[model samples]
Target: MDIENMRAFITVAEHQSISHAAKELHQLQSNMTAKIKKIESEFNKELFYRKPRGMELNEEGKKLYAQFKKIVLLWEETRSMMNEDSPVLRLGLMVSKNPPNFDDAMKALYETYENLMVTIKTGSTPKIEEELVNGTIDIGFLVGKTDMNSLHYKKYGTEKLVLVGKNIDKPLEEILKHDNLIISSENCYYKKILDVLLEDHKAIRSDFVEIAALESMMNMCQLGMGVTLIPESDTARLGIRHYKVIDHSCCEIEKFISYRKNHKITGVEQQLMNRIVTAN
Candidate 1:
């Protein structure tokens, strides 16, 4: 019934190896074994079966895992809602991709709570999460489920990202002969996706721009200087249009907010988060 047992169970399910799970959970193998056993005993069900090679979930274990996952999510939500301060909420926003929604969210969050001191940190996920762990920032808007240990996640919205270019069409063969290719620096996650898209199409990237600022990239796109690809929703804010890669779609980055699973914040951050979401 304890959170420790569920934690151990989830880790083991992820790796399917007791030793690996123990390492991941930062506990000794024997200790994790004991915790798992205690939980199984309490529930009166077999959680995992030791095969000749490795551990596999039994029918009961699978059912338990499914239920436990939902339980943990709800438990964390309830815990967060219960603990909050009205004074201030330190927020970190990593710009994995610029958005039509994110800017609106930022503005609404800042304006809605007049008394709350909200410090906005803007950078890549790696940059923001470093601050999150170092106690400089309380929450981070990052991409996907990273291996930041014990971070609780809440998903917001998804914007479809595509490879884009100016005066470009669906058939890429005719377009490849042109000399211009747009790229932001490696700091942006969108840049990484663009690199792969270029390589896949056998397109030579003769032009490149390394703009670290999200606003700067949009400015560049609007000038008709060169073509750039960005999140579809994001492009509307800028003065340019975008086209999707019907032939080649490589990746979709998930946007999520992360905070320490143990550190609960209800009215402090959630109030602003809700305001921004409602405004959008």
Candidate 2:
């Protein structure tokens, strides 16, 4: 089967209209329709349901679409590798209070491959994992654990959690009792650890505030609006004053580097991974 035909099929499946796909691909609508028909004739299967609304993929088309996406990705990667002129790396990073030395790794990669193009996407661990599984990203750096069997993970390191507030002279219990606890989100990993710490100290806050941005969180903490639990490294970098290190084992969370299990790691990827591991 022609790669171009497969690409056309994928495009039509995505857009649900040959005309729209043709416009996006810069091809004539008739040419796009012919390509789709050619694919259907070759497979001897009706891949789409053509209604007045648009063309929708049937079950057979859905299955083939998934496989074709992987094939196209592999083909592109192989072609780039063969060229030996330029390579692209897509990275998915989870939001972290204390991130890994990914900058150093990226710098090393750039030095080694002058023409390398790097793309980065930042999100939650689940989002990163989803992108990795869908082949949208080449690698991911995330906190917490993953149960995805389609990907492989390696322990990068651990981040120490710390409690930061404006007033450190007061007792831990008094601080918790008087101030609100600021958190990035309800699902934040730090919130979970804070809950555990509260239970251990038998402390309860008057209220809690949710702020999404890290800089905003820091500013809130600085203003004495509330106390928050964050990575120790972040506290130092942000020049946060009055923070107590949480010594409990649970305070240190393991970080991991994740990638698709079947992904072909090129020399560039391997070099980047090596630098990251070594730095950690």
- Highest lDDT, which number? 2
Show how many residue pairs clash in every candidate, following the order shown.
Answer: 0, 0
- TM-scores for all predictions: 0.56, 0.63
Model 2 lDDT tens row, 132-173: 999899988777755699887766688887788777567767
Candidate 2 residue runs with Cα over 4 Å from true position: 1-85, 96-99, 201-207
- Choose the strongest candidate by TM-score: 2
The residue-level lDDT of candidate 2 at 171 comes to 77
Alpha carbon lDDT at 39, candidate 2 = 88
